[model samples]
Target: MNAFIYFPVYLVLKSEEEYAVYYLPTDFQSPELFVPRKPLSDQAKRAGWQGFLYDLSKVPQGAFIRIV
Candidate 1:
């Protein structure tokens, strides 16, 4: 089986003085990636980014896994 889903790549910055990271729209990059699909939290929905959620458990391994 073949399956695909789209997700926005976030450019997170680690705080120089803290362990926290920051996610901002101004910082982003284009990269091919595959990850588990899950529901977006209510807080994330307010971010206004577009994405889709799909169960990929049935998809065969190596079908979408990317190796660098």
Candidate 2:
């Protein structure tokens, strides 16, 4: 079976800190990223960036022995 999904990316940053991170996609087929914090929050906004296409096929398949 083949499955695909859109993975939203976010720009997390503080006053002087910044880095790219992965966010979750909304159920409506569109992702909504919200940043709520201190002064940094003001600058934190949707980067309007596109998510990369992740291919699960590249991952090695293994037996699931544990689930928690």
Candidate 3:
């Protein structure tokens, strides 16, 4: 069996863009996954930033597995 690890992510908003910042442990490894989705809307992107703080509070730190 394979073991899985999770890293912390911070979503920062710059203007109307949402950026995902990943926080990893010293031994953390990056995943090799690809996304198959369309892009996000301008409004949705802005909202993502505005709600980042709230979302972080609810989710476990370093437990963010994925983002789209």
Candidate 4:
């Protein structure tokens, strides 16, 4: 059997009406960057100091919302 572990990505607010996506790979020092190629959800607007999880492959509907 094959085992798999899924990690979390984040939708962080950079500034007003602006945002950036960060992929926090396990044990990695610096987070990988992913461009927000599409329109974001309302959740993104609410992303404060504690950014929300934007897990992609793990979400049943291919993610709760699109950020990239």
Candidate 5:
């Protein structure tokens, strides 16, 4: 069996009228990992911090993470 890592991501949409954010969990490891090239934008960087805080509040204890 293959193991997968699910990363919680925040999708931020900015429009002239308003800004919206959505939280989603995505499987980080898969056969299709190398094909797509989706990089984070500057706005994402700002939103990421907020997203992280949100995820941390909800994630259960003892979750393993590696920092590089």
Candidate 6:
């Protein structure tokens, strides 16, 4: 049998928008660059870092949310 695992991701784009939410696969090296290529979700700030956790995934992909 084959096993599968998924990691949820929350990230911020370089534009005016805040961040994006998606899922990433875990068994192999991801070919995607974590770029928001299309229409991103509307900005909604949860209280005190809520919802999914993307800490590890963010570091390698470098999807940190910077306020500019």
Per-model lDDT: 0.37, 0.33, 0.39, 0.41, 0.43, 0.38
* Candidate 5 residue pairs that clash: none
Q: Which tens-of-lDDT digit does each residue in 1-68 have in candidate 4?
A: 01324355455648787776644444332222222334455578644333333334443433334455
List model 6 lDDT by residue over 1-68, tens digit each: 11224444333344465555443335422433333333334563433433322235434553443333
Rank by lDDT, highest first: 5, 4, 3, 6, 1, 2
Better of 2 and 6 by lDDT: 6
Model 5 lDDT per residue over 1-68, tens place: 12445556565778898777755445432334323334446678444332112334344343323221
Q: In model 4, what are the clashing residue pairs, if there are any?
A: none
Candidate achieving the largest TM-score: 5
**lDDT for model 1:** 0.37
**What is candidate 6's TM-score against the reference?**
0.18
Output the number of the lDDT-best candidate: 5
Worst 10 residues of 5 by lDDT: 48-57
TM-scores of all candidate predictions against the true structure: 0.21, 0.22, 0.21, 0.25, 0.34, 0.18
Model 3: worst 10 consecutive residues (lDDT sum): 48-57
> What residue runs in model 2 are displaced by over 4 Å at the alpha carbon?
1-48, 63-68
Q: How far is candidate 1 from the true structure (C-alpha RMSD, Å)?
A: 11.2
How does model 3 fare in lDDT?
0.39
Q: Across residues 2-68, which tens digit of lDDT does each residue of candidate 1 receive?
A: 3433343233345667443333221222223334345557688455444543333534443442221
Local error of candidate 6 at 4, Å?
1.5
Residue 61 shift from truth in candidate 1, angstroms: 27
